[model samples]
Target: MQSAQQASVPQSDADRLRARAVWLYYAEGCTQSEIAGQLGINRVMVVRLLADARRRNEVRITIAAPLGDLAGMERALETRYGIGRVILAPFADPAGDPTKVIAAAAGNFISSGMKSGMTVGVGWGRTLYNALPFITGATLQDFRVVSLLGGIAAARRFNPAEFAWQFAELFQGEGFLIPAPAVVDSPETKHALLERCGLAAIFEMAGQLDMALVSCGGISQITTSYRTGHITESDRRSLVETGAVGDVLYNFIDAQGRPVEHEVNARAISVQLDQLRRTPERVLISGGREKHVALRAAILTLSPTVLISDEQSAKALLAEG
Candidate 1:
């Protein structure tokens, strides 16, 4: 009886250690080393205690903002578009940079949603690139990131491959990048590469993604797609002629959220819009007066689970008929 009582004492102490570790790490937001110092234990022991706490389901984190601030707009957007969650970021200057504000909010949303094992698909644009700096670093096991589009030949800050790689590094996860150019010479070439050049593996992975982070681009001279020379003047003219308002992943869409019929649609090398819609958690992060039509089209097309946008864009989206 004495031996059994002594053994139970260690187990009881372990429970206390795990509880303290969880409180410090999750509730107090302390780093592992800080927790170790506070508890008079080694960092490795602190790490184990936290892991054990997680295994015992002693830690659950939730992110809740005061909805009263943006509740009106959020409710309007949610009611109109059937969006699952709408996070409207406030800006001191309504005319200020929408990308910066939205990106910051998106970074928080993504960080909170992520878990130990998740396969995330990322799209590229200036707005998406802005989110990179704001993502918090973490070490997640079995985490993976896949670039949903092919790379742009020209070196640019917001390249698809670069964004995907950086996002993966933020979580210390594996990254799978599409090796082909953003646009191939022809539809046949796109099909050939996807069928024979091992690029199909990336697409297959995209199909099984747990979450997708994507942004839209308005078809304007200032838009990243046009400014980067990915879409030429003639391409723009032809796309407009076909009723394209904006593009998601280089796939042009009209006001009605249907893909515009154009040759560029066939030559584009990216995940299909329909597949994006099927992702378990689709997050659309984009805003700006220029993107009003484009953003509206995306909401109708993707039915994003979460939308991170500015107040102005939210009003503009609601104003649209």
Candidate 2:
């Protein structure tokens, strides 16, 4: 009995170590090198332990491959649309859900790219705002966050100025605001605002962004900014009649993702899509199943280099094509 007990001690210790290793590896996303250094074991040993844990069912890593389980949806859509990257947020009821997956991915991308002296232009939307929490505590260099579009419109609640300030504060960088209406009553007013010395300076800063972030407005006029009083209700009807699906940076795009021939959109004091594309990297985050069609329109029309969205949006996009 004593000899048998003695033999079981080493196995028991190994089992416990393996269990710990599995949790740290899969749950924590620790790299193999990190695991080895932390455990004071060879990297190869760490891999072996993880493999053993999996084999024994001590570590059950049930990767919920929804896009795949949903019928290879993500892969098909990525290929069809030529999207550089596509992420599907995990959620049971995606239509009624907030896009946590896209937000996390966008935050990860931003956090990884943050360094000193970089300028990042931000757009206003629920998705872009959601990404802010994930970007916290990153040691980025003295960067500046500028709003690509003016947030100070009729709605005082979802003010883009405050949003930009919060993001700049979070990143420990300077926040630059355009300090004008997102859309004016007329194109002449927009042009005049653009030529203003005060606004010109901000536009110059916005034009020179190293990186940019934006979101897509959905096709539904009901939930559109125009309908929500961000733009006049007349503007909303005009945009729909003009074939506009939604707007990006308040610039209306038609069903084919082409910019509509609207004077207001043409003169809007916001970063142009072409200018945004010229930036080294442009990240576009959009969410909601209701907005999936709009997201697809933006992807096809704007040609952003990167996209972040929830799984339902991703799956919906695949369905669109």
Candidate 3:
């Protein structure tokens, strides 16, 4: 009888080559050329072996981000707010600006949650604009993006229309924009536009959104609304007099999340706060000291299903409760 090693068939040669290639390439971090030389095989053959290994389920890759601190905070926020999901991004410099950090993490969360057939509603702000670069590009079918709010008068990087269009472009999807001013001259004009001037269709689309990505603007002087001149000095004083802490989609809200009585809220051309709450998945992405009050107000009002925020913001939010 032949020995066990001698009894093995010639097919084992290919298996051995594939295993060695995977080990050298992955474990030892060797270049394909180096692997080929070590195995005394052509580079093309080495590449094929590695491909075969992957196809055969012999190679597996995993990325484990150190998220212990984040996970704990996420759990705490979820438990406190009854939120469906919470993602806390780590920031090394607690005192540094949290826009980039929060945006990158929010982008990753949005991209991962996206599906082939889904309608996403987008809101405009610097945080949402900063998230554009971190989104992974893909082409999906039946993917639609709708701008939840109307456009600003001037051309700007973070306009509602621009953000919606760019987000749709990332997935090669369709974008439906509310082709009207963010704040009309009066409530009657806003009503006329929505009921008769083509904006009704956008509101109908908003009703069918699978998810919504939104941010809050604080009442502080440095807020996007203030900086962009959308909220004037008179408007600020009026809003403050009514106990407004911040706004979501230009609908100013108090600390308890009740919409403040303001003229701007009536003339605003955006989805109603009540409608936003009904969206299947509402994600609130914001951070920084300026935003903490706004974020809290948004949470009480929107009851967001998901929240993507920085470590400092998360801590402040939890402490508030």
Candidate 4:
């Protein structure tokens, strides 16, 4: 009689059974009818409950699918991140040369979007610098290209101006140069440089960019452009201490999407983060597991509309998250 009173209180036997059924089906590989029979329930009820398990979001299916199928992963990532577009380069060997693929993909992306009457902002980095040569001659009538960050004068690779010129030539538009070094000797120098007429004009142009092209750099002191003399050691240490993960256009941001504090950043000759955010379409092109942590940090900070990267980096990033 006491047991009968206890049993009178309703319990979700159906939900409990459904969860068990899913475990059996997925983990134990038991057939639906087998589970139903074992649980003393109707086969149809078992099927309904199994589906209900998914419908009510009780079970989350995780498929570690390869990024070789560009269409599905691209869509998944775009929807998940609320990004406008996602481009994945060819993964020839499933583990091929990342650098070459990044350059090729960037080249293809630039070729497709390099049109007339558009103001394109570009940031300096090796990958983006490499892609410059791949951009063949095209007539960019009335288009413009602006440097998103200041030019690299101290530790030269390829000139940011040259990269800007390539895009300008492709679109037959004007090339606006941000003539200040990416990092200055001091914050005072940065302020002075920003007030200069020629550089200020270019920075203004960058603020009005329609689209931007940039690459994410690594956090490693040894790997960073700053450590390589592209930017000073003091600047690198300061940025790191301020929680900067990596940079796109010399605008550093922390893990929680907060901009790092730096006196030089305010009066710097480079295009500002707020300016980049205001730009209608900021596109970032980058890849690598080494940069995965920094990439996520950048995404949180900038919220770029589109990203062009290879499979390895994408997988690494997704895994990281």
Off by more than 4 A, model 4 = 1-67, 92-97, 224-227, 263-268
lDDT for each residue of candidate 1 in 164-208, tens digit (9 for 90 to 100): 876776676888999998888899999999999999988999999
- The deviation in Å at residue 76 for candidate 1 is 1.0
Give the alpha-carbon lDDT of every model.
Answer: 0.82, 0.69, 0.83, 0.68
- Cα misplacement distance, residue 273 of candidate 4 (Å): 1.1
lDDT tens per residue, model 3, 1-321? 223432452667867867888899878989778998998877656645654554355664432445546888899999898899998888656577889778888878876888889999999898998786566556678899999998887756678887887787667688899999888888999999988899998899999989999999888664464235456778888998999988899999999999998898999999999999999999999988888898999999999999999999998989984
- Regions more than 4 Å wrong, model 1: 1-68, 92-94, 225-227
Highest lDDT: give the candidate number. 3
Clashing pairs in 3: none
Q: What is the C-alpha RMSD of each candidate to the true structure, in Å?
A: 9.8, 14.1, 13.1, 24.2
For each of the candidates, give the backbone clash count: 0, 3, 0, 3
* Candidate with better lDDT, 1 vs 3: 3
lDDT of 1 at 132: 58
What lDDT would candidate 3 get against the real structure? 0.83
Lowest summed lDDT over 10 consecutive residues: which window, candidate 1?
1-10
Q: All candidates' TM-scores?
A: 0.78, 0.72, 0.78, 0.71
Off by over 4 Å in 3: 1-68, 222-229
Candidates in descending lDDT order: 3, 1, 2, 4
